[model samples]
Target: MNLSIFFEPLPEALFGGDDNPKSVGGYIAPFLHSFPDWRSAEVVLIGLPEYRGTAGASEISFQGPNLIRKELYQLMKGTGPWLVMDLGNLLPGIHLEDTYLRLKEVVEMLVDEGKFPILLGGSHDLTYGQFLGYEHLNKTVSLAIVDSQLDMQENKDAAPDQSHLHRLLLHEPNYLFSFSQLGYQAYLTPTTTLAALEKLHFELFRIGQVRQQLKEMEPVIRQADLLSFDVSAIKHQDAPGQQHANPFGLTGEEACQICWYAGQSDQLSSFGLYGYRPEFDHRALTATTLATMVWYTIEGFYQRLRNLDFQSNNFLRFSVGFHDNPNKMIFYKNRQTDKWWMQVDDLSGQRPPMVVPCSYQDYLTAVDGEVPNRWILTQARI
Candidate 1:
């Protein structure tokens, strides 16, 4: 775990005037702040420099962790009371399989101590390894992936790559509960892949729809056990350092908001930020934006954990349901409201029923006899 080899040569800007920098082969030392028990801190930063995946991201991604770390230190300088450690980057040239195993070991150590793990990526493909970390814990975890493209590729015949999502979903069944894909767009994601997602009934949402109703999207975010963020999901203007930038995607602010919301949830345990290249960025805006996003996520998580009291069921409530027909008609009642209802087309989509507001109790009674798999809900008081 001696990390001095990596940080010994670095300037004071990187070390922040700490005792001799701790050194690790693949990891950089933490730029110690004024805190003494920092090792017992809540959040640990792990950098993965393995950039073997994607078309041209690997070479550029070597700079990802450094840039983000620098920017974060600058932007969050005055912010008091945060526990973080920069564990540096994973060494280059290790087999992808081996790298995954090592990262898993690191994450497990962090989580067992009630600490949150924040990983900075070499590429989006690192998610496969990242997710694997939870395997030994045997806890069923949900994935919330924020990316412009569906990294779920059909083939896993080669080394780990952006298509890592496909491998994770197909192979790790017991370890995973559900995967929520966010910031998806019809233009960036291939039609065939989107069709596959539709077939799977996996939770997927376009960025536009999310912006329209964040209230509804909040639940989907809270349900995640781990959040993997691909910077490409942010608009090119806001996150231009990414290898493949989407012209119209989430703004940095919107992405930060979503990250904050997810971080606030008790279910979320870890997060990883991917696809940032320092050299390609102009004025280091990309790195700064990433650092800020991470800060917000951490802040949100701490705030919620403190204010909401996870042990209490204060925010828990049940709401209305609807059923138009025993077999055909279905209704979605908002748990948050007494009158709000979202109409569902008949199971076969062949019948039309009058859509109207109804009481939660009435909606629940209608569907009392049967269970429906899919529907919509609103927060309107009927």
Candidate 2:
């Protein structure tokens, strides 16, 4: 229960640099000096300094959270209560996988207390810990990963970061209800991997599609219980901090928008932003950009309206039934948020039907007498 044992405090200079008492950093309480009474806090920030699993990652990442705080502390905090606290960085384990295990326990502890943990650090493989956190708590969850390419390698000897997805999908207790990936670059993702994901019924939103219909992704992020963002998904120009910087990827603004949407989601419980290499970050632009993303995420979380009642008056219901099928597709639109959900019937008698997050576009698809994309995928999984 001594969380400090696994964590190292923010560098004295980083947290104690300025005498100015008005910046966002001024409002944050590091668990190093003060263990936040998480019951009173809405969100917690934690950092990890591991990158051993990444193919060619560096030890410079160990200083990522500290560098991010340099920029984060300079940002302005919103008007409401400052319920955010930082737990510094997780002390690395003897083995890279050991760090993952430590992170899982830390995340589980915070999640159990209803504290949303925003992982402001780590390699792409760190999410395996985030996913394990849910398993440790015995909670089934949907996952959303924002990356440039699929991290599914068929190589049996692949490192933890390379084949983490394959390992996660095969993880036991089978708590992964659904998995959605956003901002993957088509050229980077292999055709075979795409086919495999499609066959398995996971959702993949290409970078071009997301940029064109960015606003529509709110419902998609809302459906997730945890999010893992790989900085490599951002273009080299916008986020050059990635070791595997892509020439084509999301812009800084687009990334912030996605994080804001994640923050606004009622179902989102955990978040991890990974793949930032400070050594490659010129002028610290990527760090500042990440700070902005985290800022918007926190803002969205504070502004959540908490309306998710599909059967209540807050939602307007519509049903589409075709003469040929004798089955109905039910859609619910929330009056408060204008978000949508759909009911997929479970005919197998094994489990009850599921109402999953959807967008107006899906409704339009159903109205055209076609199967909605999300519904088809959900059914395939069921």
Candidate 3:
């Protein structure tokens, strides 16, 4: 697939410090000058300036991708080896579904090629296309969405804004194994939607709970094959540029924390950020916050553990037995990163024990003869 056909070069104004070798702009300049081979690049950036699915904010000013670029270019480069290419803005299709199809094709191609694609959104609804792309691989996907409100609504007329989740949940040839929502503001989520999520056994975390338990939330995000973050999930003060931003959402720092965890996970394959609107921005604080989020994500990526072998001395194993049950709960801790994981016996007998990303807190819960909610939820999903 010739990606150039679907993308155009980024504007000159967004480029920063190409002459300064220490800056991220300088490190990424070579790829822009002459398109780098996609096969050689480990990470590729794409801007999908699409807002057709949104309701009142459907048509964006188209300055979002450039705005973020300007901010991101100013950050200093990390010592970690990174090969990145910015494949400018996507060409929106004539119809909404057409844009979705185009996004799926681009993302599907990138995932198959073993390149992680970092997407900039025109709207949060674009996540559906990202999810659809994975279906082509014929693999069950676990998805995590960070937003202030559930995007699902029964209204077919408001397809993009209110009905994206409706379509995703009901779409045939379903590949979704688990779906999680983080940083949702309770009042903003409809009662029916919340009930429906519970009925489907999907995980939903409110902003208040997440602010208090970020450690517990890490394992939840670690389960995701792909993650889509709606900038509106951040408080309006932190991300003022998003069209549907709320006042009581995640703080800028909290948002970055989750991004870092998402990057560190071995299971995570794709990530996307959506709902930026440069026109509504007053001082471009949202762009800077987003740049910081991406920077932290990259940092976590470089900090990833290459060794997955549980038998190696790199990990320490422990088993906790319950007084009432004969079964023993097993856990593993990475000596290098101090991260923890749990072993779930596969009841189906098709695979070995499932090594799930967990935390020290979960281990403590098991030691007390109480099964952590994380373990219960994961078992139900699998």
lDDT (Cα, tens digit) per residue for candidate 2, span 1-382:
8777888777776686556677788788776565556567788888878888877655455688777878988988876576888878888899987888999898888888888889977788898988998886565789999998889987987877778998899998899988889998888789998988888888899999999999878888999999999998899999888887678989999999999999888889899999889989999999999988888888888867676767789999999987689888999998878888999887686888889989999999999989998888888777
Candidate 1 residues lying further than 4 Å off, grouped into runs, are: 1-13, 18-39, 57-61, 77-80, 155-159, 306-382
Tens-place lDDT per residue, model 3, 1-382, is: 7877777667665562476778777766423454557778777778888887776654568778777877887889886776777777788888888989999999999989977788988788899999999988777888999988898877657657567878888888988988999988888888888997887778999999999998889988888899999899999999899776577888999999999998888788789999888877889899999988887777677677866999999999998999998989999998888889999886677767778888899999999889987788777777
- Candidate 3 TM-score, true structure as reference: 0.95
Q: Per-prediction TM-score, please?
A: 0.75, 0.95, 0.95
lDDT tens digits by residue: candidate 1, 75-192: 4322324556665565543566777767776676667667788888877878877788788786567788988778766665543565788778877456775677888887777888
In the predicted model 2, the residue pairs found to clash are none
Regions of model 3 farther than 4 Å from truth: 30-34, 57-59, 348-351
TM-score of 1: 0.75
The candidate maximizing lDDT is 2
lDDT (C-alpha, whole model) for all candidates: 0.65, 0.85, 0.83
**Alpha-carbon RMSD to native, per candidate:** 8.5, 1.8, 1.8
Better of 1 and 3 by lDDT: 3
Clash number for every model? 14, 0, 1
